[model samples]
Target: MSKAPNNQWWRGGVIYQIYPRSFADSNGDGVGDLPGITARLQHVADLGADALWLSPIFKSPMKDFGYDVSDYCDIDPMFGTLEDFRTLVQHAHALGLKVMIDQVLSHTSDQHPWFAQSRASRDNPRADWYVWADAKDDGNPPNNWLSVFGGSAWQWDTRRRQYYLHNFLSSQPDLNFHNPEVVRALLETVKFWLDLGVDGYRLDTAPFYFHDQQLRDNPGRGKATSGDAAFPDVNPYTWQRHIYDKERPENIGFLQQLRALVDQYPDTTMVGEIGTDDSIATMAEYTRGDDRLHMAYSFDLLGADWSSPFLHNLLQRFADKSRGGWPSWALSNHDVPRVGSRWGGPDCNPKLLRLAAVLQMTLRGSPCLYQGDELGLPEAEVAYEDLQDPYGITMWPEFKGRDGCRTPMPWDSTAVDLGFGNHSPKAWLPITGAYRKLAVNLQQRDPDSMLHFYRQLLHWRRSQPVLIKGEQSLLPVHPQVLAYVREHAGERVLCALNFSDRPATLNLPTGLQAAAVLDLPGLQGGRLQGGELAFEAFGGLLLSLA
Candidate 1:
């Protein structure tokens, strides 16, 4: 099938993130596959998402799930064949949903042929394909760079008598982007997917593409102060400033190369996953111009802060530093606890979930909604016995790992394994009883369900061009209320959200008039009296302004 005509559909678009393993299991193999995803395109389309971003499905050893790629050009058997992937793309496009696959270009599985050959001998043609450095005089790692998954980033290899760099698992070795051949080869792999009519790529660990070439020791800033927000405070990775290990200057040129390649295809784009101490700054740098990334997102919103000031400052910082660059906002994904659990607390109800959905959809950038988030699925509780993520396993009780968020999607509340698969052969991650109660089948029948609310919000958002491409300006409001004005082509919308659990009143900023109140869930019975907007707990209002 021919590609969908390019219209830069990503700008202000809603991209749904689907963790393949949890989305649907077609063959009852207890894993989600390409055919399964293909079969489920209707749900995404019906959800009003403009595109779907699939996590890694490339051939892998399954370490780090599919993030460790053994073969970039092929599909892993667990997911399905390359033909199945093609069928998925075709079907998704047919349903008017763009397909974006995750590309782990910074590293590859140790089992990858290139890594194997690189580690074989010093004189091998591919010896320089991966980062290989000599050990220090004391036979220790070349530097103090730490792996994100824990321990030293350098792993010793006997054959080459050298240590290779891996920002993640030892099995996932970092590729040497300094080698032009390596960059060329990775781009070729990317082109292979584009040739198959894939819409774009979600570049994983994007800022880690290049490292400090001099191999300087990463200067410690007392404690490891910066790490993934999803990680527990106990993981020491957060204490370091991470100067030498990632977000190096050389990465920009590589991104430009990747962007140039994708730009060759119509409407193709790239959204980078940037995790750094100053991710907003790096996000701006990576996407500052049209020559670099099409868009980028950091873990800023994915953290625990849900207050108005926090959200306001986060958006303001991005707007100030991005220098006209676009951003993609996400509240939850496979790597973190679900937002409902993170922000809603133990007693989180539908009112809070609906408020979150409204806030996320009306944000100033393209929004990515994780699978099951539309159903307001809280983070599942995964016991140690059922844990599958290595990062979570390394930290155990202190962290409890990411498996809580990676559980299989519950399709049917009453079906076996929550109707994830036909036979529901022991799922890779068990479905929790709480999650089963929020199953799609059940929510589909409820008009007030979070899922239905998301559909309504997205459909409404699409109709408002101002919401799609507006310039955002923060409005002065009470500390507990988040209010902002989005204006485009003379159309303006005042979005006010009450973050507290009790009634709050927001005095409209002087000179601003509510022309009409947009129809949104949870806004009924709200009153605008004497130039003051009264909101119940977790209430949200979107006002069309004169």
Candidate 2:
């Protein structure tokens, strides 16, 4: 059953994120494309997702896996033509799924025509299109900024005898948003997509749109930890305070401008990926007053912390600080390791993974589900030679980059490449042999499968309005047991989740009796008897109180 839309379809929406290169390859070529995604649109709708957010599909050099864009206004030939995208959008809309594409607006590939013109000479019409700066007297970069992928954020350009700032790869130069012309041109690109019938955009590295005009060096973090979702020990980029390189004051205005442009198109929205010093606070600020992004998400919950106390505190803190702004929560995405493997350990604990789906769906915000996660797929073991991620390549052995989580989806256990696609050699990334048990065809026949659990959970979530738009409050419970009450318009539901591997017990509050135990499919029932509640390991309970 497809979802029916409201004017504001994003509110409490379940967004399914698809990494195109790994989703499904249609025309072979060893890579997934728009047609492949179009063919699978029914799968998303059947999965009970309200919308689908696709990772970058624009023209790119693939340095950062489609993040470094060479052209914003056209679809990459590898992914098919603009007509293919239009067809995808039409198919998705027919399935009642709003189509949201990734907009990598902060930087462009070094081979971009704009960059080519900007670097031609000092007198070119677009000489100032990028952040070009004269080197210091010692021939060092203008500032001490660092790239999220690795070393210095600035790269020397031989043609102009100057350095250009690149927040990521040296081949991906940061656009000078300080220039009015740059902003205007980018808006035109956005308009092009909007005109083509795209519903929204997942703004990439949103705070990175603007930088410090003076090119000031960032300060050090003495005992402080990293904030850009990177562990300080793994990458030096997280060591600095990052007060000047990104999250500048100028970013808010640009966001407002972008929001205003999209506002012209009805029901069009944006969700920005925020990775600033204080991402939750930034999320609140960026989405506050509905004048900027319709909603925003941060990497705070994307970390390795899966404790009940951590989850409680993070949600509670965001609730306390957000004022009236809405926030989107995601446990997994194309950029991070799959939550099933990341949090569930080597076994990819099925019980815990199922409980997490319930918890994520019940949370008081829109939730995003990563592709392949509904099947309880673990992180694929990619050999060193198969690693294509530059980030993973630079940090090998210790960190495998994101290729493990970005493996192709498994469709049929009996089919070659697990039914991901037919390719000359293989899919973009190899599907883990272990995923054969979790393939869609196999899971479809198993009522207890993770795939069925996700579908049932999402369908049940849609019927519970309180969980959709409720005011959340933490319940005092065992540290390993996360409990919360969701209340809205005189209807209330108590949700309790056991996050451990063993059984747990909690006392029922005085004068409260569960009016009824809600039938949450695929979740083990927690019993309430003798003034106490008993829960199985990784069990979850949803009940109405009298």
Candidate 3:
């Protein structure tokens, strides 16, 4: 095993996300556990990713799966014990991989002991641990804010004769970050993991940490502009401009405090998940300096919209703005559909998956690769009865939810349970038939396969200093292709992608013209002709000038 890299290692590095419940199940419980992940550290290390970001294994009631925490310090029994987690971390470090765990700080399960004591009575010792307010005379919620899952964001708690605020399911209540003690306690949780030798944290719903303490109503976001049911026409939350609900200025102070703790540890970093609709702005704010998040990412790249112009505009915006901060890119995660399925149009070729990988690796940000993505795997098709995700069950038929993307990885197609090793005949979620056909064992023997392409491209990227730490300039945007230049100490690399299925030729920008086109998939070089380059269907080009 190689030695672990330094703290700045995450900058422009790749992090693989592991949804622990479905990563691997060593105990035959039909669910993945910490030991399962510990055994698989070699696979992750061999994937060429610099770090591993494990989703929550913390103690939870599973109301919202692991997002709703019951305890901040211990691992959930369903995942494994504390010793199992420590062993996993130790093994990951032994493999030269940094471990980053998910921290769901925005809210806690209604069953959490802290929330239990807080809601016992308004005057209890822990009464102010969560957000609780007096109900209006009409017995309605205290404010107009709505939960992201649906309905009013406030829950009526008869025990305290008050309405507690929740930005998600009623079973998951928002914590009062306004309480200084709550902040101190959460900081202690951060220290707990750091003391355990864990590398860092991925803060979930980071901007939602603080709410409008005055309980002020939010203004409307105006009329609907799209037909997507997720952003429904009748949803009042979308109707309002959520001024007081979240993104409070108070969050900066909290971030500074959090950063101070993180700074105290050597070679540690924090990446936040910002879910605001105006995600680019939020990402910029969260990662604006060394005092806040080391980096932040949003759903801008994870949504259904995929076009050359859209990506061009987004990259241009980031290049022009986002100074003093770093951006993180993720094509798919536990929450969204797999990129191969989402972006693989009817006219797109499977070979283009390698091109997509090249683009993700060469972009001006740290990249996050979801499990099984290297094999060009698509979203698994789960039947209605097989669905266990609350998000999918609540909005079934219209929005199938995230379970399709969270299906277990397929190591050996011929093995029972696709080599996941669950003793029971039925696994938690049914493995996708399409994924079985592209299992790892088959791809491992095929040199031209997407998995092999990822290996070659990642190895090449690791050797290129300019690609890893370079300044970006958004080149002139073309209709069917997006172009950009990454420069470091006078060394330049041009990254261009043909987002459309049809072949298109475009003129290269001035400073990018002299490149010897480096075919990332094959590592071969070609000269640019007539100041223009032609890209095949869904193809991408990374050109380097000698």
Using lDDT, rank the candidates from best to worst: 1, 2, 3
Candidate 3 stretches greater than 4 Å from native: 1-6, 223-236, 345-348, 522-527
Candidate 1 local lDDT, 10-105, one digit each (tens): 989999999999899999988888888888889999999999999999899998999999999999999989989888988998899999999999
lDDT of 2 by residue, 250-312 (tens): 999999899888888878889999998888888888988867888999988778788888888
lDDT of 3 at 463: 89
The best candidate by TM-score is 1
lDDT of candidate 2 at residue 51, scale 0 to 100: 90
**lDDT (CA) per prediction:** 0.87, 0.87, 0.81
Q: How many backbone clashes does candidate 1 have?
A: 8
Any runs in candidate 1 off by more than 4 Å, and if so which?
A: 1-6, 522-525
* Superposed model 2: Cα runs more than 4 Å off: 1-6, 222-232, 423-425, 509-513
- Backbone N/Cα/C clashes per model: 8, 0, 5
lDDT of 3 by residue, 437-506 (tens): 7888888889987788888878788988899899888777788877788889889888877777787787
Every candidate's CA RMSD: 2.1, 2.9, 3.1
The best candidate in terms of lDDT: 1
| Model 3 C-alpha lDDT versus the unseen true structure | 0.81
